[model samples]
Target: MTVALMWEARAVAGRGGELLAWARARELPRVPLRRETFRAPQDRVLVITWWDAPYDADLPELPEPDPELVTRAVHRWRFEAVDGD
Candidate 1:
C-alpha cells in the first residue's frame, strides 16, 4: 500500500530561514519529496513535507539542530489514498 505523511514544525524566533534552508539542502538526495513553508503573522514559520512510500519504511529524518538555539517542533498527520480512483 502507498502512504502519505504530513509533518508540521515551528522554528524558534529568528531561525526560520536557517531551518528552511537546512531542510531544502537535506532533501537534495531524495527522489520524491514535496515540502512547503508559511510564515504566521507573529513571525513563526511552519513547514510541511509529503512523500510517497511504503508504510513499513521509515520516513526521511530531518537533521538535528543545535539544542540551545531552537525548540523541538510539532508534527501532525493523516494517512489516506483513493481506492484506485
Candidate 2:
C-alpha cells in the first residue's frame, strides 16, 4: 500500500518566508517515494510526502518548527490511496 503524510503549519505573523525555508532545508531520516511543499495566504506551510508503506507504518514526518516560528503546533494526517490511476 501507499501512504501520504501531510504536515501543515502556520507561521507567526510575517515569518512565513523563514518558516518555509526551514521546512525545505530540513531532511527526513528516510527518503519517501515523493515529497512536495506548499504555502497559502494565511502564512501556512504544507508538506506532503508519499511513501511506499502501510497506512499505519512508522514513516518519517516533518517535525514542528521552532515555537517562535509558528503560531501553533504543526498538524499532521495520514491517508491511504483509495482510487487513482
lDDT of 2 by residue, 1-85 (tens): 8889999999999999999999999999999989999999989999999998888999898888989999999999999988871
Model 2 Cα shift for residue 39 (angstroms) = 0.5
TM-score of 1: 0.56
- Candidate 1 regions with alpha-carbon error over 4 angstroms: 33-49, 73-78, 83-85
Candidate 2 clashing pairs? none
Please tell me which predicted candidate would have the highest TM-score against the true structure. 2
Candidate 1 lDDT by residue in tens digits, 1-85: 5455554455677877766665555553465455666655432445555567666566664555555435765555646556751
Report every candidate's CA lDDT: 0.56, 0.93
- C-alpha RMSD values across all candidates: 3.4, 0.8
Per-candidate total of colliding backbone pairs: 0, 0
